[model samples]
Target: MDSHRIIREAEGEVWVSCKIPGKPTIRGSLTSKGISSDEVPEVTASEEFVVQEVTKNRITVSCPEENISCTFLSPYASFSHIHEKNVSYLDISSGGDLGVSSSTDQTFKVWETHNTEVKSVLEGHTRDVFSCKFFPSGQEVLSGGLDSLVKVWSVNDGSCLATMKGHRGSILDIAVVADGQNVISSGQDGTARLWDSAQGACIAVVDDSYSPINAIAVAEVGNAVNLGSPKETPSNREVGTEGKLVVLAREDKSLEGVSLHSRQSVFDFDGSDAFNCCTFISSVGVLAGGLDGNIIHVDIRNPKSAVETVSWSETPVLSLVPFRDTYVASYGNGTCYIPLKGSEQVLQLTGPNRQPVFQVAAWKKLVYTCCRDGFIRKYEIPDLG
Candidate 1:
């Protein structure tokens, strides 16, 4: 791992699909935020997952009004269901097969969800597997965790192909672009690193606001601050265009920016407490909240890149997201949806307090979080008001 990969916070969510007595439940986990080690929970017995399973490559997810869907599993691919238990994390390829990360025996598990069969087991990562995502092509998959190494595995045989060592502590968050040529990661090291997905090389590094990165976002980390690797010729140009990642830095008091292509510090923002997770909405030239009580925005064009403005909050801010080309933030009280374009006012989600929001996964269109009282929630975002 690189010496600079240290961070201070990973205040995001850990997601698992499980079944309660009869209803569906998602054990929301908190990780993937800033550039520092995660803080000790107010209590030590905070759940590690949404549910604890007896078997390694197996999770327990509850379907609404059903006895849990005992379905099929496939090759190195993602499941059709947004959430599944015993499955660490799920990734779907264009082909519809599912790739899953599991900590059962400390291996990445692949399956056919339709039949619920195991395909292959990838071995590595000393601790529980945090997440597993497949390449856009589905030929390979990436897994990360507490042991602090990102392992790339071959989908064909479930073999450990290569490893990218950069973080100094546990790796809590990992995200792959739609193209799969690049990847972004945040951990206890308070910094984020961009890597070449194909060669497994370090491209650029982003300096987080002295906190562990629980979640990360990388698109063109701030206007060519540095191109982490050489420009992608042929299909490689796509590596720098069209795709972007919005990281929810798990910092308690601040946020920063980095160039995934060059791996350099792009900018920073002041925070009151560590942030948890975030996402990029290129449509607005803005990045939103997850940590502090304020929803901060960054100006991607300037050299001294920092937060431009912040929407004040009354509770702990957990996640930031760009929905329908607008901006949204989830907090301890509820969710607030904001429009970035005009003189629009922010919309708040009225609810109870201590809604432990782990992160906002844009792809699922479901704002997933955990309640302080111990119930997981998946807030579905509707396209229409």
Candidate 2:
């Protein structure tokens, strides 16, 4: 099989694409035993009732701190070393190159796992590039920072392509919204700005909050599932792109988060500030994590709004990230990893090294956490466990 070819499952059946001419396809049942990240036993199954085949390979999964080892195999390359300077965010490009924006070094590094070397350093963001990502086509780079500027650069030459302004305060987060044509930016400025990605211009300002918007995700609405184009824009419309952003506007000066849609705070008050560090479950329309270390599932489609809420902390919570439908919340005291519909047993990871976690990003079963102690630890996740 050609390692580069796609071999992932699509429907009920397992899939394998053998790029090599003489190679045989690997096939099996998709039943993997589950366990917690700390090596605790767990029941493993696909909650959706669709059982695909799981394949085996040469790689072994290990967690030194937990003293756990398991046989695991995958088609893609695995990142083995822990990142330096507490990785605040880890983004993967289409080519699988990693963009690790950090606070420890106060710089963004581009890494290639094949060479195990940093290919380039995105050195423009003066402060931490809190949110950095490649465009959908992976031709350009976009980053926001405490510097209050959103910079776009060419992926090939690494030269500045365009700089979008208007963020009065530190830009905490950003998203390539409106189907890659527009960029949605949120910051301490208490407003979410919609910017023209190609023109590097601010189109509209969604000023629904007096508090900092920690995160914003744009989702296409019905009929307007597409965005405003330059040539196709209406004469009466002020902005070109018009898509709904699922923004988590944290209340003034704290973790109090509000779920926003269509430039309005529709769902509010779940915690001291759950919306501040919360993340929306993809395809599920649930907002997870807020104040009181709890995650609130707000169904935007529902009238009552409050669908479900889960408390993972007593201490002031910092962030909540979704690993599939399940989520992990980082607080001052500990980190709680939970699955929604299946496992009730909360996987708690706490230690001397586990300082207050500020932000977290997970890939596959690997987690990258940024802490106040200025250290980042990578741990293997128990997907089924």
Candidate 3:
């Protein structure tokens, strides 16, 4: 045989084909020992075979002529009826026991991680809730809504604890500073604001980009990059805001970095298209997703250009989150991809049938995604640390 091919059709079926020197192409379903060509005399190229083993690291296929193995990732579980409309965003708690989701149905929900049972229904937003996240303590949720308001809710009782208002337009995304004392929010008003979670007051307008901010991520970038000093004395309420970098994804096709303490622009990189989402993969490395499906990886130390650009599809990239050494990205096509950090191998999670997966979150070995199909799918990856 000169060449052979193996393709996974579904959960347990793998298709295999090989070209022989003289005779018709040999095709068969994989058996315990090898491909049983005799048992499947009329096997077509599209027919699926049985794979020997499928795991997080590798997939092994045994054949009489040769053996084939490769890495594969797939979904293992799914949860339905979590919302009535498209689930716009979701975040898993640091404890990995709870999850919170926001949807177009003008509602927010907190659920159990194991079975996705509804724990509490967060109410108060007159419009759609666009973003929601759990605080580090896992006792509260911070949410931004189309009503141009940011609110904090108690996880134990589902009661609205605080309602923060300042932006003139819709609140698009949010980020919590170190601990749970302060939080940052981006809005359609073209500004990012730092707010005291306990007092419900805006500490300062961190940056007014003049372009609608779609998403924001905060991280302690350390002293490697110049964060600039504050022009005025920071308010005493600004807790744990020092040396933090806030990255903004804007509608003007710009990815900008700002100092949380100094409120200074650190760096800016123009993107191929309007940015929709962004996240910090490391202290100094950031990933920004664009409307044109480009995921630009940038190093703050040298922000003149992207370190690398990758695209999984032409569909818009909606959400991004760091998962172990790799990152997870969702798209408008209802697909999620896990691109390994240093390899060409890409794992796919499919279930919503191209209905637009809006957000994805990871906790330990489990991955949870919310889609336009009104379902929250949970995948348990094997051997995932």
Candidate 4:
């Protein structure tokens, strides 16, 4: 019997693929305690191969009636790196190649997503940076900090392009408008303000809510929804912002929706506790998490009650990212859950050393997470087929 290493393991089953000389590679799962001759498919070699044990790097199996060893290597072994300080926020570029992170060390850094090489350190924020995001074009970065200012930086040269100030308190979150021409920010001062990125001026203030907004999500609203026209049009660009709604997770245990153009309250629903994060699963379907260990999914048109409520852990949910056919959420207890829309089984992601996962970002086949442990963990999704 020849030795074959374990390639992938899930549940109680282990899988190994073997490449025999002068024959095609054989892939099969180990059943019972050892491998049977029938388990190896497409192997026409005269040697008898049997798997004994699959360890971290080498597998001891029998090949041609003799024990031999096979080596295994992970493809994603180079995708992990640690930041110098605790990362507070993280975002990946739309192209899935650039990664941006903000830390409690009062600095923001951009790096290559694949190799984890530092591209540039964006410096200028006098206080802790709370929120950072890439524009749709991925050419610039917008960050808001405890200094009560929002700064835009050039991704190419790490130069501060513009700094917009007006918030009386720290900016908690930021949302980029379409085409990177405008942006919106939510602050601890109980306001969500819109800005003109090119002119670096405040376009409008969506201040319908008196509670400090913790998170903000912008989604396109279809023509079916009634988004009234602006009563006092500030700019001709008001038409472009009409068919969108800005969802806000407030510190007062309420989830509010405001029309992006008209600045009118669309709907508001009270949650189990003060909301920490919010996101849009679809144009109409929204999800929000709070301190009471509840994640509420609601429809904006009929948000009088939650469409569904998910409660898996007693810890507060801190972050959320939309995945294929479902959304993944991270909690204060270092637990992450992927709850599908119509399934009872929830996928749990663990490996944070019981530290809080501060933020999560997904791009292509990889999911990136930043934790209080100061490490950015990347997970690769298995091919379903």
Candidate 5:
């Protein structure tokens, strides 16, 4: 008879031990940098068991004699009671210390990321707040809601600094431009608008897609791409508006890129299904998640077709966020995955229990996810070796 045990020796290393009655114990270890021997034997002479793979989220092991293979999911820290109803969205501050979350309960909260303690309640929205983000300065927040209004709030005191109203329908997503001087928002009104954050004025209607814009991402485009100059003199208040592109995920199953300065369409790629979220992975790369769970990666330089499309499930992808060399994606099936770039390995964040994960945010190596189950989960990814 034989016995075996597996243990996590440290953040990125796993140790396994196997023993047979009246025989010396066999030990081995696996690490992100591959097998190691300083802490434990790289592999025992018996080779009864082996550590097959190691990742930030889980480890896999196999034993031939036992004819068994098993996977162990890493543990995570969770902040419960963050919301009363479904948590619609969450964003971590640039400083990585604070976070803001909006819920279907018609409430938004600024909280301490260390412990998820409520810092302040932002209470101006008359309807469900659908989207929220921390400004680059991390001292304020911008939010859009079902009330068809965009509000900026002071993080220090939770005061509504300004309310910008223009959309005839609910605001679905929001993006803050450089330095927080200006912001952009998309809505059910089928329009994307750029607003002067301080004055609560709409600088321009960036795009009128004639279909609901479900999500948007703003980033500086490559220098070679021509962003036509503004027809009229640009507003002096529009900081970081030039050379930037806004990617719109439309309900009409199209992903379009519009130049911020000229409000001209850069490219429009037809998608297989309605896109629910989008994000910029690089200066020239964009990723959009569709309702059918397809994650389409497109090169803005040549947006005639997608560079790659991957789908893990038929469930709708609710959120897409670039993290390190990879991106984290959340689905309506309560699953979240971190697909490592240039690798076949994918890390899954466990705990949602089939409850739809509405959003995923990353800061440094920490990943935060909000779910319909009213819990905010924080995953501290071990430093990759």
Candidate 6:
């Protein structure tokens, strides 16, 4: 493999451009304000290009003799490692050392992200394991599956510590609190529930939508954000637990938010189509992607209207992840878009086999995508020049 890195620097906006061995000349720009400018550079490649100019907000490269000039940000992520198995869901640990992946093979495994070494194989689910994630502690893992059970495992020994059961349908997604004591899950049975990871007890049913809940995310909202009330307060919770919300993507074509602690509905916004996944870009801003290939951004405080709707491809959006100053969305067609605020064009994640990208997880500067092609594609963001 050829080693190359595209460097970027930020001023008011960041500009990046570079050339890769087998890929075309990469170019683009990223802004924090979601503004696009025509002044942005073009994409070009040549047998040779020279660094022509450098500015706080811009970098220019040109092949003077070939008359090729391109300016703007270059691609930020490059292919890293690939794990072979039809991955259904995956998450990187907070410390960025390990990854937990669940596959169509009905197995869940833990691996070292850096050198691609399989560390532990967790077994217990009788059916397909649909979701798996690293706890905030990174020493444990949480997984849910078609077996209608949630299992907690020790990352070091691969021993199943606890299994919580109740959902009538396949478990779709799982999220953990910052301290790892609590877990939140959504399922095909149209219910979202919170679990006490330590004791393996169902704390409460957060929602019963009557429509399959396709995906879920746990986000820590602003300290002052308020959620109404539940029948009972969640137990054994840590400090700052009041600020957490469970965002759900439902089969009813709606994006919903429920307080993790209160088990109360915060907001439910009708979407253009069935929501496939949801995530948070910040405490106040939430994003949901749907089967209509549209990704909608809304302000939690005023969700009467979407702040912005981005239509990238016609494939169902399977995953959304916050990346740097922007966010990345992956689709059923294996197309992934990383939107730069000020750039009209988005960065595309390449190297897919046109299979469904089931999940996306990021740790530090590295991004990981689990695909139906039985591959977990890894990408790394380059350092700034």
Index of the highest-TM-score prediction: 3
Model 5 poorest 10 in a row by lDDT: 1-10
lDDT of 3 by residue, 1-385 (tens): 1111223233233333443234345565432233333332112222323344544323443333433222334456666678887788899999999999988787799999877789999998999999999999999999998899999999999999998999999999999899989999999989999999998999999999689999999999989699999999999999999989999999999999999999989999999899999999999899999999889999999999999897766789999989888888888877677765554445666567768889999998888988888888787765532
lDDT of 5 by residue, 291-337 (tens): 99899999998999999998755689999999988888888887787
Cα-based lDDT at residue 95, candidate 1: 59
RMSD, candidate 4, Å = 10.9
What are the per-residue Cα lDDT tens digits for candidate 6 across 55-138? Answer: 333344554443444333333332223334578888999899998888877778898876768899898999989888887789
- TM-scores of all models? 0.54, 0.66, 0.84, 0.79, 0.83, 0.78
Query: What is the lDDT for 79 in model 2?
Result: 41
- Which portions of model 1 miss their true places by more than 4 Å? 1-123, 154-158, 194-211, 221-252, 262-265, 302-316, 327-357, 364-381
**lDDT per residue, candidate 4, 1-385, as tens digits?**
1112233333234443444344555554544343335442122222344554443332334443222333222223323343677888999999999999988766689998878888989999999999899998899999998998998999988999888888989999998888777888999999998988767788888874678999999989776467777788568543357688999999999998888988888898998799999999999999998988789999988989999887656679899789887887888877676653553333445456568888988887777888777778776654321
Worst 10 residues of 3 by lDDT: 1-10
lDDT of 2 by residue, 147-214 (tens): 89998877666677778889889998887763466777888878777677777887767554677887
Model 3's C-alpha root-mean-square deviation from the true structure amounts to: 6.9
Candidate 6 overall Cα lDDT vs. reference? 0.73
Predicted model with the maximum lDDT: 5
Q: Rank the candidates by TM-score, best first.
A: 3, 5, 4, 6, 2, 1
Per-residue lDDT, model 6, residue 230, is 54
What are the root-mean-square deviations of the candidates from the true structure over C-alphas?
A: 15.7, 13.1, 6.9, 10.9, 8.6, 9.4
Task: Please state the error at residue 63 of candidate 4 in Å.
Answer: 37
Q: State which candidate, 2 or 4, has the greater lDDT.
A: 4
- lDDT for model 3, please: 0.80
